[model samples]
Target: MTTLAEGKAPVHLWVVGVLSLLWNGFGCYDYLMTELRNEAYMAQVPPQALAIFDAFPVWAIALWAIGVWLSMLGVILLLLRNRQATTAFLIAVVAVLASFFYQATTDLPQAMGGASYWIMPAVIIAVTIGQWMYANRMAAAGVLR
Candidate 1:
């Protein structure tokens, strides 16, 4: 049996924290690979997709960096039981929204404008929001301090 008063985190916290870490880890990896233009990694990416990424404005790229890096940091904070995880995740959410908004307003390549391209961003936005909400809930519950 466990209780909040005991100051021991519930199993669910660990579960969610680990899962969030892995998910965000991949985001970080993608960001690094794309920014670094790693040859082997870039090789597998479609040429149209690469061209679209190559055209991103500096501000959009900055937002993308913030979104990926901060989300990873937020997950780390969550696993550490820090209340600031909520704030980190909130900032990440805003950055992601801003980055996606820029993408939406731009004219992307026809091959890159398919449903397949949209699905990943949609999923990323949903998961980012979910992580923020979960962190907020955990903080409110005294599970994160």
Candidate 2:
């Protein structure tokens, strides 16, 4: 009884959802365990940005790390054919959207826009939203069932 479009939606959503998880999970890892953690990278960042990060306690960072990993795990589960990953993806999306809105409203308007690096985040957000919607529609159509 399923249409072609409906069957495809879940697949597309799972792919994008996996990508989103990898994107952020790696970022968390980069911050916690690589050259990015060194003073050199920290030195290059604007004082205000550094200050923003510093404002949050270490525990907050730990929780964020855990959240990132959980989202990645969710992606894996979803890709493994578990529709419950949709819920985890939604939580990840919420966190991502909040960060996106904060950065756009604050950091973006203040920057000189060098390299236009912000495009990466924008693209990721677009892909994530698209995936979420696609999955929701497919699930509603009983594609996951």
The candidate scoring highest on lDDT is 1
Q: What are the TM-scores, per candidate, against the unseen true structure?
A: 0.95, 0.56
lDDT tens readout by residue for model 2, 21-94 = 67756766655653245776676777766665665555545545544555675566555545665676676567
Model 2 — which ten-residue stretch has the worst lDDT? 105-114
Question: What Cα-based lDDT does every candidate model obtain?
Answer: 0.93, 0.58
- Please report the TM-score between candidate 1 and the true structure: 0.95
Model 1, residue 56: C-alpha shift (Å):
0.8
| TM-score (C-alpha) between model 2 and the true structure | 0.56
lDDT of 1 by residue, 1-145 (tens): 7546347888999999999999999999999999999999999999988888988989999999999999999999998899899999999999999999999888988888878889999999999999999999998998887
Name the lDDT of candidate 1.
0.93
Backbone clashes in candidate 1 total: 0
